[model samples]
Target chain A: MNNTLATIDTPAALIERSRMQRNIARMQQRMNELGVRFRPHVKTSKCIAVAKAQRDGGAQGITVSTLKEAEQFFAEGFTDILYAVGMAPHRLQHAMDLRRRGCALGILTDGVESARAIVEFGRANGEVFDVLIEVDTDGHRSGIRPEEDALLEVAHVLHDGGMRLGGVMTHAGSSYELDTPEALRAMAEQERSGCVRAAQRLRDAGLSCPVVSVGSTPTALMAEALEGVTEVRAGVYVFFDLVMRNIGVCTEDDIALSVLTTVIGHQADKGWAIVDSGWMAMSRDRGTQKQKRDFGYGQVCSVDGTVLDGYVLSGANQEHGILSREGAPDTGIAARFPIGTRLRILPNHACATGAQFPEYQALSEDGSLETWGRFHGW
Target chain B: MNNTLATIDTPAALIERSRMQRNIARMQQRMNELGVRFRPHVKTSKCIAVAKAQRDGGAQGITVSTLKEAEQFFAEGFTDILYAVGMAPHRLQHAMDLRRRGCALGILTDGVESARAIVEFGRANGEVFDVLIEVDTDGHRSGIRPEEDALLEVAHVLHDGGMRLGGVMTHAGSSYELDTPEALRAMAEQERSGCVRAAQRLRDAGLSCPVVSVGSTPTALMAEALEGVTEVRAGVYVFFDLVMRNIGVCTEDDIALSVLTTVIGHQADKGWAIVDSGWMAMSRDRGTQKQKRDFGYGQVCSVDGTVLDGYVLSGANQEHGILSREGAPDTGIAARFPIGTRLRILPNHACATGAQFPEYQALSEDGSLETWGRFHGW
Candidate 1:
């Protein structure tokens, strides 16, 4: 910001605050129009400022991938939080501790095995935990299918075992692979229908399942209707990335997170200008590798946030990234990006890339920068 | 280590202390037998505890990839450090400051442009920087060719400009692609010959090139003799992962680092048991993707550290890993690795994986554990 890139250290995670705020406003407005409470996943930034901005933009609550996030956000005065990952039994005590501390934390379970553990832990601790049953709408990762008998069984375990069956949620994570609006809309419908179906099953079993939640960045932005869904959640939309660009969800301009790097050296003959933001800074997440158009580590941008059409980080090591043109080699790469010239690299996955940094240098529209701390690890 | 895995949180970075010490001993012993000083790269562990073990075992100094590492390690009393990446002109002031603060810091450069900058900065500051000429041994990443005229040009620029021509260094990073002992040994020789030749060029040009350094984890262990080499540098050997195992550098039993995770849920019909160690825990290195043996994200090991044949992390999301057998679906995955079962995941690239965590749970042979803090970011 304010051309201070020359002064800040190389390989710094930079948040283009203006773009980020715009992205937040867009999502919040969309969710508002859709008539559903928007719970933004804070796992993308893990920064209180970012989540605070979301909340400021009308995010009803926050979603987290780990209990660590729940604790950190809770400590930051965000009481309504969801530890979205399927609950591991060993983490029951930790989750219960947060609940006991009055964090209003919501724990998720996909099976009777973990639901039983949650019930047992609650019974032993004399606490009734608010539980969300994870339903799988897509064959991607975790959760029980909406039609599976385990859905009712897990719901009954939580309800009959004296725990508060709060809701059912599903993430169409496989929506990341889609490039068409039609497919995204269908997937959104499926996610909404499947999660709503699970909620119905619980209610039919005489259990109170109040919340029906479903979303992913693509589906959330493309869904024609929410129908029975009470809330929607999405993470990476906060700082769109190249992978999202490839999926036709967001443009490169929507990307807010970028790694500010300095040209360290060059391999002139190979048409390479080595930058200081390697995998350690940009992260090893090659989320764009198999996409329709692969942005080799990231898409290169001018220091002022304008996209550099051809240049990309074509290769990377522990601490060096080879920035080069995509088609033929830029033979005058050294002249093009001389040593000490600062540039920005838009990451493939904002969540993975942001996790690589301890703090972000948030660049505001007024050309001022703010240091925002982000928590790491569980 | 004692089976205290269950007590520790899932998705934790675990260092097998005994195995790490043994790895330190093995590398130190090889360096001693070769009559070369060993400077273990601190980039892999960044944990002063791990580097301390290497120092006590016979490593003379340490190799670091960034100035942040130099600062952190210097603060920890590791005054002798080599900043191995190509020196960026902007970082010269920081490097000089460290030198002024009594850090025997060594910086590197590959071409005339950066070499000129280093010389000018040193002269203007009246601080003679200890500069290493980075020689390209295998045409991998950075560094000038060992036989190129620019090698001597860089040396003369430092020497004539009133700076210390510290020496020459080369990392045989290409050895990571070799699996056989013969190929590894050959790579070691190539690395040695190229770096020694560069140092010879400097000495022949009447410049003081006191040190000749060479290595990588594979090359450092496989080199038959050091000859004119003064020191060897290697990282990741301290915590060998699947990439090293596939490179035939270290055995499964010798790997000292792993991710401690627990089964959180399962997609029984799909034979997928989801664990807490996802890309966020294990990293997205995929270093072994092109190697002879591709360990998806990581290799599966029992909580006690025994390698589980045919079991691998088939897919991973941000917070979930799909664990399944290789050739066939383990239909009874739920019964085999039920909910709450703790497991250890050996990562693909230890350097990349270890950086994912802020600290490591060091497990001692006596069943005791110590928390070793690791610094992250630049």
Candidate 2:
């Protein structure tokens, strides 16, 4: 593999380096202009190579979805790590180890049970960690009400237990449900306000909450104002996928990661082209299911890395994908490529699909291969 | 870690040794009575430890989804292996190497392109590989039509290129869609007839076709007659999941694997309990989406390893899942589960969830932990 030059590689993930750098820089510039810290989530690309790019591009810290990821990134010299998932007692020992290793660790918690568990674990282990109260801006997933008194009660318990109250964090997971930029912007405000209001409740209770984090790629990219948000944590923007395109977040040209597959067969009667990249390689993440048009799994691209018009992967099995054009122009894709011809498929969700493979064959601007490691499992 | 006894370690993936043994023996006896060879697909449980169980239960051969799995099982003294995935030119050399090590290797192909590629690779490497012509039974994924002349053409091409034609194989991927035993039996007939007809077409073309394989857990377990079928290659039956239950293939008690997760939080107002098991652990495979009752991701069970009547995971984020009542009696799950209480989740799709984790903390009949070994990955 060449350090600077490149060639296409098959049966591997091809990530565009320049596109990733641009995405990171774009997010950083926006956050910096708004006077907010950028703490991009590390779950999208569980690779140290991409995390370093974020750090180099001006990330003050990083958000992780798993404690395993926090440990891996910390070992690789990433000090300021946030375990974004709701922390449990079974994983407290691992969190304490990260703190002992001279790293600032922040954990997300919502209910009194978790808050009490954290307090009890901290008291028993003599470990003082940062706690972030996860506020549910939209009823998309887990979190407590930001404006409720429960926020202060949870904060008081953590503060009394010697654990520093970091602040409040909320993901506008509902932003992924938006159909327009205005909707995304509105959700972004809700996310910002939710975290800020939760932090304000902590302040009203005489607690010094420092950081207010808000995130979700769709909202983070479209938000016009950060307001009271101290930091932004978005992950999927580094590798925009088909889901982003369907939601109008990006275009086909903006997608940076794809699965390289080979044409295995053709059904002339049905005008179906079979490819080796199936749901296993592309992932069954139907993030685009809510969109107006559902591209079964992903958008089919040509061997030269160009998105083919009217051709979509209609369905996928475990090891095979069916490429078809429903009542569209018949270009005879079967004749264009004989068997063994390789093509790249832009994924529906980059994080989900990329997680399927162990490593990525990073492609330079000119299309050369450079292997980059991807961490897996919790 | 104890070699002599099963330990009560994690609550997730508690395997009942006796139940598994019975399931294996039943399938083996049924296939034997049908006069069809049992080549259990090993992708369901990539653990060599589980493969040993299959071998001990009289599995003559094993099917693998990846070359890495083939290599691993071959090293474990499993000589006969069928690489069930479509043969790509890039991976042909690896398959040839496995054959050179005195392993009986069979490759699957459905397209003329793959047929030609496999022939070219085999000719170049001077190796003879047994080939299975995959027939598309219900259009679930990949394969040629059983009645299409393309099947004969591909078989003729393989024979002309000096590759031995092993027989025909077809999977009724739609069998997973059936909700009745009658539907399953019908799918089994369709699967059997499809492969048998394809083999007949090859024989009519003056080609020697010895094997005719038909499979799918539902079809294999419910089919009354094997007729012209030479072998069965069903996977999922060993570790039934929520999807199987929804499809009426197996009951919740038949499921062997479950993700043990600790309750992290709860939304008392919404009546939701949050667990540490997310898509990262349980997988994003919503296999039950087409069923009448869509198990959001999995069925929730008590810590004692019993399925709760009405509890089902309603939604999942990257690292958190929400469990709520489906239709059964309310068990006050939200109030009962504290932050540290452990729960078990039966996966929607065993193959997908099993692939996410590195190893299983195998359990015994009495809910005690057994030995652990890492799974092979590409």
Candidate 3:
């Protein structure tokens, strides 16, 4: 059977190929202008086809959050991969295995203890592992501050232990919280300068620091310059979401990912059009809640991707989404969205939402559709 | 490789067998005392092993939120299955296909348009589907009100159009909001009376109404009696979560599902020990946010399931979780949860967290672990 939007099952992930290409080109162009290599984070899509599109758009290597993504992408013939999350001691063996299989995998570490473990594992395996010292640019989550003692300590541990101290990397993930260009540009500068400072510190300490990498979708786009950074990494930009829209990094028209759902029932008096796409399909990422504009669960759209302003998925159960207008109850909801009427919902966070579905229905501008499988677990 | 909790990969979904069995037994015993057949909702785990455990614990049938769950459970020999979500017209053929293959799959409907579509499809396809009219008991989401004329109209449409009217069902989903026992019991009665009243209305109109169903995790347990209800359906009770705990239905110790993770690094000044399990593992289910107690992502527990009071996953990224103290930053977090330290996080919602993983690591009492697969997408 033809897998058009109408024929496919409800609650299926839909990717507008045209918007995806545009998003991909936009990021690549920005990185190109900045004169830094683009290593698109595969953790967002985990789909080889999507990664291949990024590669075709000039992404040099791939960054992944888990070793499984490295393994999956490597097996599909994309070799240069970076395991971006801090290396766990228990997963060292898996990383080693992937590297030994000719997957040119790069791992990250922020703490002295974690760096020691990576060094010990690499030495024991007689493998010169490429390691990046995680630099804290925004203090959002993981990573050591550029000026922290642990930064030099981790670098010395990996370097002295016969491992490749590739460089320093940091993500200004805090950029997601900024909606203005001024704040985003400042965060971008902070991310780039922090990583470069860490790299310089290692170099000044008589350690070889080569590739300096930094980015987050907002910072990557808003950054005016990347004077010292050798490469930049970003995810969730290929399929801009409601969160990204609210962050002022991408326009709503740039969003490529949506869940194709069918109206199953309605609560007329309450003005709720019950749809099949619930938290189970759209995911539980309420990233837009704290942003300037809160798109409860998601922004509602027509079946063909026309924005239905003011209508959003106000609430969601396990398998049922309550689609309603934002201000007052549209008492004519039943008549507006009668049962069997198909619609699409743009998610709050593309990474979380895309992870919910096993495959995405990639719809081309010509109306042809293709099913692209995605990895589920670590 | 031995698959003990210690040996499994970090960021894995872990289910404690003993606690799950106890939870299953508790729910089953309550249904027995209340003289109602229990149909555990497989939407919680979506695992054949989990459903099998419920069946072994005397669960008579299964309730599913998606057709995929219905198909999977039926394929595993679960014959008395109920697709509890309101039936979409497009899915009628799939339902018929299951019934044609000897699966006693029951479908639900609440609106006249949906009922008419079901009748039309059933008549044209020469199938008599077991149809249940959904009654909205608590005004939480979908369903026709018990006293609404539409309930009778939907019943007649199904019965008079060559379909087997399977009575009525309702879920007091809003019961999840109440923490007090009085409020819970009242909500349970509201759900029960509302569904029973709908069945009575159908019977009073000279229609054969054999089944009357009502439940939600909170209501199912708090319900004092089920005077006219024949069956009960509850999902999250099979593996109670923090949301259930906050609702006063289960204690933190009763939570059987957790995300097994290992400390990969630390943000010392912030009193954060970063773990490999992020929102990808724990899910973005901030279900406890508005509750009396809000667990940022989840409550932190020791590797062996002991609750570490005041420690919670305060922040999460794609592949990183920040474990921190509730009131103050534990400045010695790096020492307390050093690298490679294994920990488990009790999720806010079991169903949402469980869906994040492709399979679960079921840990038994004797320090044994087994991998059980779960369905991902519909």
Candidate 4:
């Protein structure tokens, strides 16, 4: 028996398969036109089906935030995987194990101390680890600046010891804060230049720096050109969320992931229809709170996925979301959304919301639902 | 080799087993003294070991926020469970299935429409669900007011229509906002009296209101007396967090759950030691934002578990937590906590943080760690 939206359980993560495919194609097409290899970050969906679709749409290799993702995707037959987060020493053994198992697993690092640890671990284990020097183009998180002398120093530590100095990678995650095309385009250019510059510096120092990777959904989409960059990587764009929408990267209709929820009860006088999608379901990611338009929890959609204007999740508890109108209290909230009403809530952050679920209910255009399993935790 | 604090992976949820046991004992003792049965809300930990410990410490039953949790706990020999979320009509079939499976699953309802649906579903399925009317004691979330005419109306709807009107239950969730003992005691008394009044109203109207239940971690700990309350229920108290800390119910030392993370890299000039535990590990719940003292993402503690004054997760990305000093950037952060430095972060909400991980590393007093698994989603 095939399950439609009606038959599937509430508080389940739903990926509108058509929208997801379209989102994948849009990014792939842009990457194709830009003349760069597209490595879709598997960290967003973490489901093989979604990663497979991205690959089908012309993704080169998968980029992952955790080694667990590399292991999972590798088991699913993905050979080339990049462990994008700065590699911690303790995880080196796990990374080495994955590489030994035929996973072309590449890890990242930014400092001299970390580089020494990586070299030391590789030397002790009698293995050469493929390492990417994480560059800080935006100064938002971890990474040495592209022009910093430390970049050459870290590269030397990995190269001087027996290790593959893979290349340079930077994520201009600060692009999330920008809304205008100019700011996004600027961020993209900055990201591309910084990463490419690091690669140039490594080469100037007579070292092997082949790969040059850079991205974030905004930078990936708005970049005018990918001049010296070999590849671009992105994750959240596969399921464009409210955060992306606010950043002007994607529209609400472009959002592929939403939590299918049920209107369980209501507080009529308060004009709140309590739904089953709380922080536990929709997630506590209030990514929209600081955005141009704050969708408290999320924007409420009808059962058929049509936008229900003004109705938003005003407040949320563990398993209960209070869905109310944006302005003037939704006086008829009870009658408007009676008990048993199934509603879809577009999440604030797809990655965060997706993590809350053990499996994704991929609803195709024909209303047939397929359970796509995704793993969580390290 | 057994994994300990030094060896276990970073960004892992660590439950201080002794602290958890103490938390359980404290709540159970309070309920025992108040002359009421204690039903620990398992939604916080969701680990069978934690639930078993609660039961072992004198809990009468378990309260669940999801049917999935009820099913999981039931499979683990926890038969007496209360599905505390409002009764959504779409879930009636699932509820009936659980009841028929010999699990004494108690469901909740707050309105006549839902009550009627329950009775209808009950008659059609010929299964009498042990139903409780949720009362809004503190005007926080779900439930009918004690004095509302709908209280008797819904109770009669269940009784007259042939469903078991087991009792009335209310959660003084607003107690989370009050920090002073006077305010908490007032809220606790209010939570107790209102729930008792609602149960009294149902009994006065010739309905069998066998139970009068009420609780919230703050209220449960501060309540001078339970009065007519038959049972007290609370979840976060099992692993009290900063929210409970600020609410004056528990001190920082009482917090049992902490995210064990490692310094992956550093932004020395910015005074940031980027850790592997980001929003992905801690959860994007900025629950402490509106509190008097906002610990950005969480309060940073040493690996050996001592609070580092003026240190908090100033910022967090997907898998990168920017650990920094509160007032000023510690320029010597790189040397102060060099790369690979292990640290533990006490989260704002234990329930939200715990949900981020698939399993917890329960660290004993002797510093040995054991994995305790927990489930997510509907």
Candidate number achieving the greatest lDDT relative to the actual structure: 3
Query: Per-residue lDDT for B1-378 in model 2, tens only?
Result: 552122232324555567678778888999999988999998888888888898899888999877888988899899989888778777787788889988898998888778988888889889888999989999777788898878888898899999999999988988888888888898899899888888888888889989888898889998999898888988888888888888887788888888888778887777778887877777779988888777788888776668876788888877788888875534566667767677788888988888777677776655456655556236
- Best of the candidates, DockQ: 3
Task: State the lDDT of candidate 1 residue by residue for B1-378, as single tens digits.
Answer: 433666887788999999999998888888888899889999999988998999999889899999988999999899999999999998999999999999999999888889999989888889989999899899888899988988888888888888888899999888988999999999999999999988888888778878999989999999998899998899989989888999898888898999999999998888899999899998989998999998899889989999999899989888899999998799999999999998999999999989999999999877677899998998
**What shift in Å separates residue A340 of candidate 2 from its native position after superposition?**
1.0
Ordered from best to worst DockQ, the candidate numbers read: 3, 1, 4, 2
DockQ of 3: 0.91
Q: Give DockQ for candidates 1 onward, in order.
A: 0.86, 0.54, 0.91, 0.85
Cα RMSD (Å) per model? 1.5, 2.6, 0.9, 1.1
The predicted structure with the larger TM-score, 2 or 4, is: 4
> In candidate 2, how many Å is residue A99 off?
0.9
Backbone clash total for model 3 is 0
lDDT per residue for candidate 1 within A1-378, as digits (tens), equals 344666888899999998999999999999999999999999999999999999999999999999989989999999999889998888888988998898999989999999999999999989899999999999888888988899988888888899999999999999998999899899999999999998988888888889998999999999999999999999999999999999898999999999999998888998999999999999998989998988999999999999999899998898999899998889999998888889999999999999999999999877677899999998
- After superposition, which runs of candidate 2 have C-alpha atoms over 4 Å from their true positions? A1-10, A328-331, B1-14, B327-332, B374-377
Interface RMSD of 2: 2.5
Write model 4 residue lDDT over A92-159, tens digit each, in one string: 99999998989999999999999999999999999999999999999888899987889999999999
Worst lDDT run of 10 residues, candidate 4 chain B, spans B198-207
Model 4 has a DockQ score of: 0.85
Q: By TM-score, is 1 or 2 better?
A: 1
Model 4 clashing-pair count = 0
- Name model 4 segments beyond 4 Å from true: none
